[model samples]
Target chain A: MFNLFDLGKIFEISSRSVKYVFILFIIVLTIGLTESLFLSPEDYKQSHSVRIMYVHVPAAWMALGIFAVIAFLSFGTFIFKNKNFSLISKSLAPSGFIFNIIALITGSIWGKPTWGTWWAWDARITSMLILALFYLMYLLSWRIITNKNSANKISSLIAIVGAINLPIIKFSVNWWNTLHQGPSLKIMGDTTIHSSMIIPLAIMTAAFALFSLLIFLMKFNTEMIRIKSKGLDRL
Target chain B: MVKKVKLRIAFLLALILSIILSLFLILQSLEKDVVFFLSPTDIKNLEEIEKKKIRVGGMVKDKSVSINSNKINFIVTDFKNEINVSYSGSVPNLFSENKGVVAEGFLQDRSYFKAVKILAKHDENYMPPEVKEALGDK
Candidate 1:
């Protein structure tokens, strides 16, 4: 099975794609910024402050999406006994953590004028805070643990356990009457948001996704380089 | 290697299961308290209204807001029920008639509330001012 995922081949492919991903990310980001910040119409009620949603919503979606990816990868590491899965999880964490913090901060800033408070212990807000803490714990486990195998075991365990909070975070608004408004864009049903705004939001989300992927590839390449320099065939 | 893998699997399963169990117990206990605020209807149905400060959320009834000097008075309604909220402080910019709002303060009675804070709650709909104007909203 190890023969299926050759580290050198994976490293070669990822390293080569980094430059192209970087270029694509820059192009998409510029378009996203223009659409979100300028082209997107001001919210009828919120006025200009609603532009922050372009960054805040995408950052939040990325944060949640990346964490879900990490959890699945971590689970794979255990079942397949694949160190590569752990390595991919490790590379994905920093970008996820960064987006999580971005989401929280942007949310706080948006909350001030809209919700009339900079911070509220509403279920949605508090659950997101807990998710950030869980991200911190997952990242810290890798840094604090000295043994590679132990770190892999502990971090994967942490991710799987923390995943229970994912559903909790998603349903927090519905389950509890929080200060945060209900979801505007429903996956299965009709969306309340106007298409003019939704187009920009979609572009921004794509740009953020590309940005996270760029970060993952760069970080993964660096890890591969480090392993190669250490004269190790596998993690 | 196989033994070590099995041990890791068992260990991981135990941790995941225990965490889920504990979280479930915690959330179950905290369920009632977890709601950010009660609706006007929720308050009306309560068996006993406590003296402790609480939050009630609902839409501000249209043409129901009144002001006298520095204090503001408004009626919060959940369509089925309504409560009069009186506050001495300023309200959020978004606070308006026919808009969602949450008031935190003491419930004076079943029909009256003395509020300390008024937080405006906006709905999820978003569009430009022009679009709203074109839609014939005055």
Candidate 2:
């Protein structure tokens, strides 16, 4: 028997992680919101609308990063053939999708004031939309499929397959006729944005990431309750 | 159970192979669709200017921009080749003469492009990675 999916052990550890979430979220909120509203300089061109970057960029990062995490967790399911990985993936899905929607909505809000249009068929936007659809479909598979074993197996496959969009989403602006600007941060080069802006953005990203952890734990607990009700341990 | 394990392994291996093959084919086709937009010099080097929409990126060619009330005209050059672009819209605030810009639309001919969208660099001295890469050692 595979012990990786042992529910009791997982819960014991996760509840410990939960203890830190509250304090982390408070810190997350204070740093980004305060800096964004106060310390950050106004864009010489975009002006105050530039503040949207503090939210939009971080949310988009969560959207992509969390989906990658889901896919990685799904891969673990296949390797270990354990239900725990699927549960984690399922728990992660809603938060990832929520962030994806936030990114798109914030992006459109930012676009209207800056890019002169709320929507475009630019490659980056198109790819991100596709990614959101992939997330939706992954969640739907888990909902629509009734058999626990088959549902878990199929959704794991879907999650892994959908990961094809990850690289595309990352490279779309670079590889296509996109109006979206390429990333300001690069591994090999200097950060393009003003140093004043980076702090707020980093804080926002950390806040969003912490918020995801809070949601993930709640969802994981729900999944645990679900597994107990189903009584799959007797199998 | 041992026999079931062997069968499952075979099935999964096949599934992974097929997925890999399909992804390769999809990306191969997407290769044609994702232009990442072309450089001005790439536009100039095209054998025949197709009717399909295309994107061109380059500097705004210092002093080549002409602003009218509605339509604006400018020259986009990669320092090697240039294409004259005509756009009808409010120009982006960062749009100036000599900064990097990418325009998307159709090529009227080899030397002229009619653009529907104009994108300018976002931050100060922040060049799009594509533009910087295309510019090479310069």
lDDT of each: 0.90, 0.80
Model 1 misplacement above 4 A: A232-234, B1-14
Q: Largest lDDT belongs to which candidate?
A: 1
Poorest stretch of ten by lDDT in candidate 2 chain A: A226-235
- Residues A42-112 of candidate 2: C-alpha lDDT, one tens digit per residue: 76556687888888889999999998988888876765576666777899999899999999999888877
With a 3 Å backbone cut-off (N, CA, C), the pairs that clash in candidate 2 are: A175-B36, A176-B36
Q: Can you write out model 2's per-residue Cα lDDT over B1-138, one digit (the tens) per residue?
A: 667657666776687678778976886797646655677778777898889988787788999999888989999998998999999988776688867777889999889999998877454333333445565657
RMSD of 1: 2.0
- Candidate 1 residue-wise lDDT, A25-128, digit = tens: 99999999999999989988999999999999999999999999999999888766788888899999999999999999999999889979888889988989
Real contacts retained, model 2 = 0.20
lDDT of 1 by residue, B1-138 (tens): 778878877887888888889988988898768988999999998788869989999999999999999999999999999999999978888999999999999998898999998898989889888888988755
For each candidate in turn, the interface RMSD (Å) is 1.5, 6.5
Model 1 TM-score is 0.95
